[model samples]
Target: METSSVLIINLLVWFLLLANVLSFSTFEKLVLPPSVTGPESASFDRGGEGPYVTVADGRILKWKGPSVGFVDFAYTSPNRTKIACDGTNDLKFGPICGRPLALSFNYKTSDLYITDAFFGLLVVGFNGGLATQLSGGYKYLSGIDVESYTGNVYMTDASLTSDSTGRLLKYDPRTQRVTVLLSGLSGGGGPAVSSSRNYVLVPDYINKKIQRYWLQGPKKETTEVFLTDCGSPKTIKRAVNDGEFWVAVEKQVQQQPVLTEPQGLRVNGSAVVLQTVPLTQFSDMTLAVVQESNDALYVGSSYTDFVGVYKN
Candidate 1:
């Protein structure tokens, strides 16, 4: 049978069966928890330490010391305050962001670029103004990050194909062109670009690895492994102060754990430890971390719908 004919027949049967059913579940029917409440004035330490704040609601989780900051898609820290941008979950654009999962700041432009799961990308002014969309009709964009050298944007298309593959795209505002930089990356998502614009660190979600690519050289020779079998880091962001990057691995155990939960890794000063500081109740779909002017840290999680905070 022709593909269209087969699809029509399947649709007819599905509609008939669904019509006979009393209640049906839909994407909208899926229940998302009420947003977590955040703190009015969350506290943090001076040097790389603090508690984690749930971005959407701003629920503060205190610790013996400080925690790491990871803000997903919420308002930025307005004057060193970590704010979450709870994006829209409309179906037409909702599935694209899955949770509006990108966080990046352009110091030169003083603008924040966020990739809402429902909308492609939203550009908001740092000084507070209208937030606008940057792209449209993308299957899924996991996270957004900027290149320090040229102030260009890079993001991930988690999957829109049969192979469960993903690709990287460059957003050139001058030309308003979104071009695919690399493709066929198995489960590629969460991009972190180097300050000098030399390399990009990407998390291979399905492959359980972190890969780096040279942006200047030929595309074919660019892909290289930064860390393989590195738990299952879902999202990554470059540290603001240092050139090192941080990755949020979903979980340590696939089904059941024998040891610690998966943690974030900071590539800095020849020191990398599987952090014990828990950032999310569930492994956040993306790790949205940024450095604040006050030297604190903020992180975000899609599953929890809150931004986690830590003192930097």
Candidate 2:
């Protein structure tokens, strides 16, 4: 949690996550615009029309199409300046420029929620521009997801305490209150809810597993390890086609953490590896999230200036 400044740029280098892609194929690079970099996480609208990404320059850009390319959708910092912050990877400008990490959309409300490293939770209307902060004072905010049914937002953070533990927290939009759902998390991306809403999976990146927190059941409020040896999952997202999850993972060598080849692992609730998509084709880029929209996979990275999409 103390690694506040170091965390902004070295997220993938420290802990990682990703979605799903197919096997035996290469990712088509969606090279980012000038000066912008590290499309760390990707999200699509309810209408299935995008892969709007949060970039290093502290702005979220929407991909309109190949012709229109990426246009500024929303920004986190009210003090953000195009001249000073645009397209730069420097962490010193985070507080002034607002370093955003993960984003999700409320399908019903059509409001986009974001987790900014410096600004905490922020939201913008469907119209997208400068975002309004909902909450702040969180340290090392990473992943975020919204439950469409309740409109409640759940997220993970490396807490500010010296305990060196991560936490899974929930925000109720109705009450505008934040509560700690679970603590002692190894901490990765946002908690992923089951389709049934019975439980949510929070990735423990350092431990290379996912901790499942029960939301509804006899086991409600209990915590358990759902998946082990999950290859340092970067991001855990619900799959587009199946009732499963696509996790971006990095294979660990000899139990010591090393950033080696990153891959896409699709798995079911029973902890079965359904499919593995080799992502070594991207070469040196440390791929973070491989989110799927419509039918194609959109891959984002913390070390590159592009979001690689897999095309047939």
Candidate 3:
């Protein structure tokens, strides 16, 4: 009887552990049409009426409803024609079709700023159509974020060569001036400013680290590694909580063939991880952006034909 009781207790303990491991919310796929692929990043408007996404085919699409699906919001290049650009992911046509990667909104002006993999940075007003080119002359513009209070844009240039020739830049909408904040970043991912607007967290994808750059306060203009050993973080977005952020990470597992596991982590301003959410259900896709709105998490991928929503 004593042995049987001990066996039952151990079985219960293992059951609880398994339950904890499966505690994550199940992700429901938000499927896009065949023409739309690679919704790399998602942003919502001031009115809370969108999960507007930038697709690989060079268009920013707005989600209207389940029936209407995503409608055309904006295009990066004015020369982009449907015949030449739609439903394609060829890098050679990137210069003409304009592969948009990251997106953020300026709430004050109701304008959206985007980083094109080929076109550098661009913006469009509330009534979207053709986005105006704000800055260019960069090899690859990977990520972007807008300061809601000042309308200034922070962005990252991933690389010039195969090495770590990346750079972090700031673009002033008022003056139209572009300033380089930092260079020598190893595959810079994305920038997410703090709630106080005093610091920005930038991810180094190649180095598997996140760096914090102070924009204000006593540590102004200083940069430091916020977190290390992060598995190829892609986009860092401000969390719903103050002084916290959500980072999307892609973990590569090498066996005979390589496998990828995606995850989302919540970290505080002091570089402490608060929570980690596994996104392995979308492992086949490159989860580039994980954004939080209300109590739900929105996941975007640059290689999948769907976005994912996981609600807690």
- What's the lDDT for residue 167 in model 1? 82
Rank order (by lDDT, best first): 3, 2, 1
How big is the positional error of residue 150 in model 1, measured in Å on the Cα after superposition? 1.2
What is the TM-score of each predicted model, taking all chains together? 0.62, 0.88, 0.89
User: Rank by TM-score, descending?
Assistant: 3, 2, 1
**So what's the TM-score on candidate 2?**
0.88
Clashing pairs in 2: 16-234, 17-234, 17-235, 18-235, 18-248, 19-290, 35-87, 36-87, 143-190
- lDDT of candidate 3 over 1-312, digit per residue (tens): 999999999999998767645544766877776767898888999998778998888889988878888888999987899989998888788879988998999988889999998888898999999999988988788889999998889999976455788888999978999999988788757889999999998888878898888999899999998999778888899998999999999877765687878889989988887778898778777678999985778889877888888875
Query: How many clashes (backbone N, Cα, C below 3 Å) per candidate?
Result: 44, 9, 0
Sequence-dependent TM-score of model 3? 0.89
Predicted model with the maximum lDDT? 3
Model 2 error, position 222 (Å): 0.7
Q: Write the per-residue lDDT of candidate 1 for residues 151-219, one digit (tens) a residue.
A: 689998866443646888889888888988777766645788876567787777767777777787565
Name the weakest run of 10 consecutive residues (lDDT summed) in model 1.
22-31
Q: List the candidate 3 regions with Cα displacement exceeding 4 Å.
A: 1-24, 160-162, 253-256
Better of 1 and 2 by TM-score: 2
Top-TM-score structure, candidate number: 3
